[model samples]
Target: MRQSPALRILAGTALALLLGVSFTQAASSTKAAAPESSESFDYGTVDSFAGAFLAARTAEADRDYPNAIQFYKKALDFSPNELELQQRLMIALFMNGDFDEGAKLAKLLEKDPAVERVTSVALSFQAIRDGSYAKAMKSLKYEGPNDLDRLMNELLTAWTKVGEGKGKEALKQLQDLKGPSWYSIFTNYNIGAIASVVGDEDGARKAFTETVTDKNGGATAPDTYARAVMALATLEANAGNKQKALDALSAGDELITNFAPFKALRDEIEAGRKPKPVIETAAQGAAGVLFSIGGALNRDGAEDTVMLYLQFSRALDKEAADTLILLGGIAEKAGQPNKAIEFYRQVPETSPMRRISELQLGLTLAETGKVDEARAHLQKLIASDPKDVRSYLAYGSVLSDAKDYAAMAANYDKAVEVIGPAPTRNHWSVFFQRGIAYERLKKWDKAEPDFNKALELNPDQPQVLNYLGYSWVDMNRNLQQGLDMIKKAVELRPDDGYIVDSLGWAYYRMGRFDEAVTELERAIELKAGDATINDHLGDAYWRVGRKLEATFQWKRALASEPEEAQVPAIQAKIEKGLPPIEADAAKVNAEPAAEPKKDDKKT
Candidate 1:
């Protein structure tokens, strides 16, 4: 079953702290190391150490890593003994892509517990790169601040054991490293990878099979699941089980449909060629460790920290399309769409992920206001592969954002045609989107059935329930059923402010002014900055005879950037209160009340 949007967001947030670094240890150590002085670089030549320090801190806060690095260096010149400065500088250097310099500084501060976690991870990567297996193991031996840290320490240590040609010991280490439920996928995948490299096909197959079947691990750590599938496929291919290898690839496709490596291996199998091993060397295995953890952290919204680990992985395996895609995603999340474009552009054209990257690049371009270029790019994709639902979805999404409802509806119509009439549960989104487009175009007759079809395909989808129910209420038809649906939607997605607003608005439409005021107030609290909800609350307040509060809310709505078409009416409401009930009633009685327009924004 598909996870709800709210559930996904909550999961991501919860997982963000899963790999806790010992912040308390770092903080206490930082205080003790603050006052030391060194004679390394002359500082008297510079006028104000305090000013440079403040500027460096400000730059760090602003994420200007380059400037922060420069300023921190200048500050360090004056106070070479300051451990805090070294720690900040090392982080700044790392973020600025000067890993060598960062590692060097980290080595000097290796004994300081405050920066121990960061320093240890950095120095270990350096040692692993230099073929210093013993040194890498030593660096990883230090106690980590959190469960995530401890898990990584053990995993990396196992990889180091493999590096030292102790494959049995490495497997033993992984077998014994107890951790949270989420850690099983990583450990098993690593064990499978190590066994593959050591020619223990049976062991590799058993480990990979367990990893593949782990549902919790698969949902929480999809990249590791994908890797485990690839490892299993490689083992099967080596055993001359061509069909089994193909089946393994198919299974992986269900987790990551566009993974380039899996697609490459599947092609080799189809052509009756022996596929290369998933992990042939200890170095690559170690790189995979970093890549898996980094990908998981990125999903958990720790983009800044994940980027550094991914860079380390990329340095080891430059051709890793997964790492590149992840980096692009991180850049996009950080609001560097142009940087994201560069990363996406770097995906090798032969990779299946390249198509997904192109889609991302097109979307990023549209986000940057290059709508024409985005449209052309997506149109070309559609022309190249008319059967690719993603291309049509991307094109339709761009049109939807641009408020071109007609074009959006037409695009989805094409998608529906491509998908044919035998729509499955997976095709529910297409119907739902088409419904939204038609509804936005004010074609209620066409829109309502599509929504119904979506509900038929995916029963109890809260978004569909909220939208269809709200429409029914707005039109004053099926009032009780509409209210029931809205209530059910609220139950399903209690935290959705838009759905709550719909409930409040339904009450207002029924002229239950007191009830409307109560629900609308709750809705406003839930969606504090929403112009439509605020306006709805204002109308409800006025109906309840709270003229002053109504005017205040109308003014707030005006300031909140309501639709251009809505501005004049809102402004008029603010300047002059709503017309009297007698006049409104007379008008309503003279002309049969037309169905009220529903809000354009969907839940």
Candidate 2:
């Protein structure tokens, strides 16, 4: 699955919903209403109902699904006809893994015109689980309101057909799916799965081959691509083509190294054991469908919606390590690192992905402020697997975060040693990070070579170009070349304020006051709150005779909170203007005597 950029700019309404602030108004409005009673017991009053609802929303915002469910239920006991409440309750139950109760609520919600696509999907999965094939087919027929929704609906329908024992028909349905070019990889992958489950070895081989060969397969649907490769490898191993099976596993490994299923299959093949079918039963086939779609949705930032699908998938196939990893990732993204750690911990010890999960767990431990534990955990991983460069990198990153540059550099050195002298293009990050570490330690000679090597390996990488260029210009060496490099970096990352500031500061150092003023103004516009950029702009303004503007810029810089060591200097400059330069007295005195001697010779 390809991760999408974060949607940090949530609209006010969405933010309110996520934070449960929307409930506050509703709760306050209901405070004066009367109590209601049930046949068996006395339910809470409207005020109590409002209080429970508010609590539920708060709990939901915090990702405390069980408490949210409890409060939602309490609120529902007072007011059962509230459709919005019903929807919230259903989602909470599903997210809490109480799918049976969620499904029950979903049955009622299916009639709601405003019901979300995820609710419909949950109902369909419930139907499938209960062996109600007709109802499942009906649920699948409800058209989705968007492109992704429609595609998922069609895919789920086809999988439902497979569950109904019409595997050939299921394959036909997938073949007929016409959508965007992005749908091709998923379509081919599911076709391969349905074929494999239906005992059509030749058909399965053909579909899996197409899926593997699809150019967009890796970028758009990596998890599905990896699954296809594993399926193809299993087919080859079954056919007694040991080398071909290994080759298939190698292909999958290139796409996603250390995938547990792929590693397990490779191990079995190497040991002369026949690997199991990738999708053995109809239920697992349904689980695969859910996993693929859910994994994709997870990447697209529909964490809550995807969580329900993955939970259902897990219920169907508990051994799906990829599903577990995706769940953990969702938890991490939701800012529930403890929950993420729990999911990561559930990865089977026999799986190759177990190590990757451990690595993530260590990072998440750090996120929770258990820095020492995270460091120790990652250190143990490095000690156990000395050749695993990732372990070293993870440990190094932890140390880097703690501002321990020396330790970070030493860890990267260990990584370089483990990787041997012949570092591949992929090893560029190791060098880049080590360079950053050395630079932070003020070891310029060591840092410069590492940065140059990083450039050699990954030419024109924006961060490397910007850093190396800025360093050279700051040191008054390679001024023009450094300026050129910084310019190129700005072009590459036009929105990066710091790179733009470097260009401006370079001009200032070269005494191009006017040009510095223009570029520095632009940099300040780009990053108005950056103290260094503000200070640099102030210096340029002062040089250009905009003394008043320079004073204002300096005030802004002071307000922006510069580094502690630099504060006193900026304060001193604000108190008194820059010191005057000494006159070249020798040059001034020698010129007159030379002119006089020339005049005497002429006479």
Candidate 3:
């Protein structure tokens, strides 16, 4: 089973119950007409209790915590004793950074077994804030579920022990931690952090040394290991061993390539600046504990738990940039672009990760359909550091989202100019993206050379191989070599249905009907509900004289929602069947009738 699966289930049936029976349906019925301002629209501006609850759930599902909190409160007022409503409201409040408010609701629900999961965390955090170490320990209890909750409880309890001035005791608790092999990195890192907080420098040094020394641990838990290295390096630097500090950071670099924190810390030590301790308080150490587990919990279906950990970490140390960035990324991936923008905007201006967050903010704005705003924001970023290739990339991404291929090409042209003529393998994406823009603009002469240049820099790149190969096949030239390139792409990315479809489509273009049918069927299995894949399969089936199956596939494509531009053509094919063949397979390839679409579907 997946780690931390039970973490989100702490609230019992609140997730489903709070969401109620009518979320989008009820919420859609309550949408407001045009407001006075062009800047905002309120889905929560509704008339009934059901509407309020539905709006709250719709917002919650979207991760729009601020709006969710407002609507949940409105719903709660209508039915005060609703356990699921109260529990969900608390979660929304916590997620929106109103930790104290969320905790207050948890306080009332503390004795309820169903609400214990949220209460355990909320109450423990409140106790930690109030400096009641014993109360914190008592508040953190959960016997159900897997070991993840138990692990978090123990770590938080250990931090309280550190707060109680039992530093040695905290270290012992961590040393004594028992769980799966995956627990080692977090355990060792916390042990070192507790030791540092207690001023046991030698103990801290030894534990951190051990923590970072586990190269396999570093790979599994790179962020935790990187922090352990920084902490170890700080201990050395403060003790007047500057070279040792540098060495620790150098080791960190080997473990996690180009971590900004390590780079910054190393620069400080090299410039004779004494490094500060990475952990200044027990609370900060506890934050790291959350981050370790929370970072590991980041997966597609586990976002709620991952977000909970990061949000709790923020409650302990509000300005922690790493927590903020991770939270923003989770929001982004969850399709809550507005929520993602809020989190990204919170990363401190002084943070090394500030620029990265800003880039994310711009992309999220575009996702939210604020294309003009995104472009303006990225334009300022690009102008501020004209020589930075990342700034150009961020700007280009906004242009790509806006479908302004000309602007995207211009952006990459500037990136190429900034990098000068000595472009390395690292610069392959710049060439590849520029090539896409040129191809999208129907300038294949320009696009082809850039694709070749990209492959020269990174010969085995699957995307470039697929694009160039597909283009050659579509143009009726270099048939065998083009097919070979596509085959190579499929070999490199066996599970990628898009690449598989390219291979099938290439065979269809060459009139190899049987082979096309086989590959297209595989592509359909891999990428179900893809209109383009279904359409291609339909065409391939028709050529093989499986007319009945071909008709079924065409109807399937229409049901999958082919683009508006493609609907009439698909309908006509279904109505009258494919036109009669004018030539045999070889002749068809020798004189191509039309270019196959390069879009996920072709024209």
Best by TM-score: 1
Model 3: CA > 4 A from native:
1-59, 62-79, 141-145, 229-250, 258-278, 382-388, 414-425, 441-446, 449-453, 456-460, 528-531, 546-580, 583-603
Which digits, one per residue and each the tens of the lDDT, describe model 3 over residues 146-220?
566677778888898998888888788888888877678788888888888888888889989999898877776
Q: On residues 361-455, what C-alpha lDDT tens digit does candidate 1 reach at each position?
A: 78878878999898899999889878777777778777877878899899999999999979887677788889988888878798989989999
* Highest-scoring model, lDDT: 3
Better of 1 and 2 by lDDT: 1
Alpha-carbon error at 223 in model 2, in Å? 2.6
List runs of model 2 lying over 4 Å from the truth. 1-78, 96-98, 130-135, 144-147, 176-180, 249-278, 297-312, 511-603
Ranking according to lDDT, highest score first = 3, 1, 2
Candidate 1 vs candidate 3: which has greater TM-score?
1
lDDT at residue 106 of model 3 (Cα atoms): 84
- On the 0 to 100 scale, the lDDT of residue 42 in model 2 is 28
Model 2 over residues 199-310: C-alpha lDDT tens digits? 8888988988888877455555677787889889989889999998888888777767556566657778899988777578766777887787666555444676667668
After TM-score superposition, what is the CA distance of residue 249 in candidate 3 from its true location, in Å? 4.3
User: Runs in model 1 with CA error above 4 Å?
Assistant: 1-51, 143-146, 179-182, 237-240, 249-278, 297-301, 581-603
lDDT per model, in order? Answer: 0.75, 0.73, 0.76
